[model samples]
Target: MIYQSFSSIANAGEETCLNCSTHVVWIAVSIDGGISFTDYQVYIKPDVTVGYGHQFVNVSVDQAGSVYLVYNDNHNMFYSYSTTFGQSWNGPFRINSSPSNTAIFPWSSAGPAGTLDVVWYGSSYYDGVNPPDSYPMTASWQVYFAQNLAATTPNSKWSQTTASGIVHYGGVCESGVTCTGNRDLLDDFGVAASPTTGFATIIYTSDQYVNSANEPAQPFGSGGGCTQSSTNSVECSHTDIAVQTGGTSLLSATTKHHFQITKTDFEQISNNPSLTIQVTNIGNEAINALTAQISGLPLNLPWTPALSLQPGQITTATTGALPATLLLAVGTIYTVTITANLSDGTTETQTVSAIYTLGAGIGL
Candidate 1:
């Protein structure tokens, strides 16, 4: 069931836009399993000048139906595979081998038939460190994940598996948007596997452009935006959505260790001021028990509840989590519920109603 379609993401679809100008084009999609798909394409740059169009393209399918793809250009991060399923595809492989400006999102996880489990979002490929000595010199982002067995060696078909599973974003910005300025958008994605314990799970999301009229938040790309230090930080990266899980067969599905919750009251609460918490447990193991609450607060001065979090703050917390360092209020006329454990083991639940103010607080 793989068949994705695209056309101007506000990038404008000028005359059908086939990879913008070619050079490298591949946004293809067509599968009949995940359910519904026939054919979609953009992939074409055999070489307008060295096949260059590599913009956000991701495709995965394994287990026997071979098909893998990845992207990211500016310096590196490219790979291709297709055992005739996608019609025919191969080598593009560079794997962030070198250069700079790195940013990959390659994702995959289809095992058994020939083994596959790719991942991305890198800044230091193999990690031996080179390029005049680099590793967080700017906005270093890392999440590397790998798997592509079903062989003996040759780099082992595909390798990486995740020597790193920690890349995050969250400088927060969304009311009027201005942790500094604006710019941040990552997607929420998923991939899973558990032959029994070969274990594998993934989640994604990233965006943190903290202020931009130009530069910093980047008015376009080419120049503008900095803060990566070996993996420095900034860009207000928030919108958090990253879950990781690896071989352990996911402990037989789950003996217990999952949880999730989200809240944001103001549906017409009048007052305005606090309450805004989010809880998650995408699973990779970890979430030993939790809790949260908020009945009302400050005489409703700024209204309060299961949201509005951080700024001055309120109360209610569990094993302790909302964003992590602290922030989870539960007051100001609202409701929130949470439940956990997932990634095989089982158990899941969540309740919500962070109400909204229809008059002065906005939400009418």
Candidate 2:
């Protein structure tokens, strides 16, 4: 068995002391049959003016003794990893890809070879797009998943994916003073991963409709008169747990592509005389063709040759040579804009600036 710990301000007294003013979270572990354990701080903040809710800390351990901790700040979900048990950690990385949305109730599981997956409920209401009065009791909570290929490493990049359609609803408190009524929020969600297959299953709570005879009803205001009488009709609080399964083999067919300038080598016009830029594809689909264009330079840089890239592939393009006529002064900053057009009918642009230095320098 394994254990974990977290912090909260709920136990604070009325006196305005440090403990009462600020909120923090921590985690601990006991590997040897719960005999002894080590503690590690997850999040800490000194300032007490801004209230912080550090809650929902979930922990998962892999066969290799690596520990993963996932928690929420009441607004977003963040995760951290500990290679040396609970003595140290690396992360507190935001698990939710969308910063504007509210993410909470994070749960995680570790699969074979230290593959980690985390899930949370993402709400759109917090973004001010779906007000309760307009669509009250509707499905606003969406389930999101993030996977870490190398869960044992601090530098592991998380790939975010959506698991369930926006059908899960309820668990949200009403507006105003009575908002605290649904504080429990349907207990919690859970996730598990297969040690061999690396497949993951997520189980979470959601509202549903039941007939008067206690039978399941169709979703989305279908069977049974379970919807609210108001304009933004929502089903009554009939929380039910649902499950969803996913793995690498069950990838979505839709094509997606993410482009980034991974590396840039720049130098003074008189010294190195050329600029090298590297582009990488971080998505799940192959890039049919890619075109790179650079602007904000003294000379009109031509577009790079069209190239093809598989998922997770990197390609480099360099300016053949900077003409000596372009006198780039030392310590002068120059903006560089790179636009990439993909055959997938998508275009991405990155604007970066670099200072003309004597030695090699980097751009975004």
Best by TM-score: 2
Q: Give the TM-score of each candidate.
A: 0.24, 0.52
lDDT of 2 by residue, 1-364 (tens): 2466666543335345653633556675543334556566766645443223433567886543457878765566677776655666787677676632777667888743356788877766564453322334543676787887666666667787767655345445423234543432354567776533456677754453334453354344454445534112344333443344444611221123266555555554334556666666666555665444333344334334446676667777667455555556644444555655555677766654444444432221
Tens-place lDDT digits, model 1, residues 94-193: 5543322354445556553345566566553333333212333344455666555642122334445343334443221211233242223344445576
Worst 10 residues of 1 by lDDT: 295-304
Off by over 4 Å in 1: 1-42, 46-61, 75-109, 112-116, 121-136, 145-194, 201-364
In order, how many clashes per candidate?
58, 0
Q: Residue 239 CA error for candidate 2 (Å)?
A: 6.0
The TM-score obtained by model 1 is 0.24
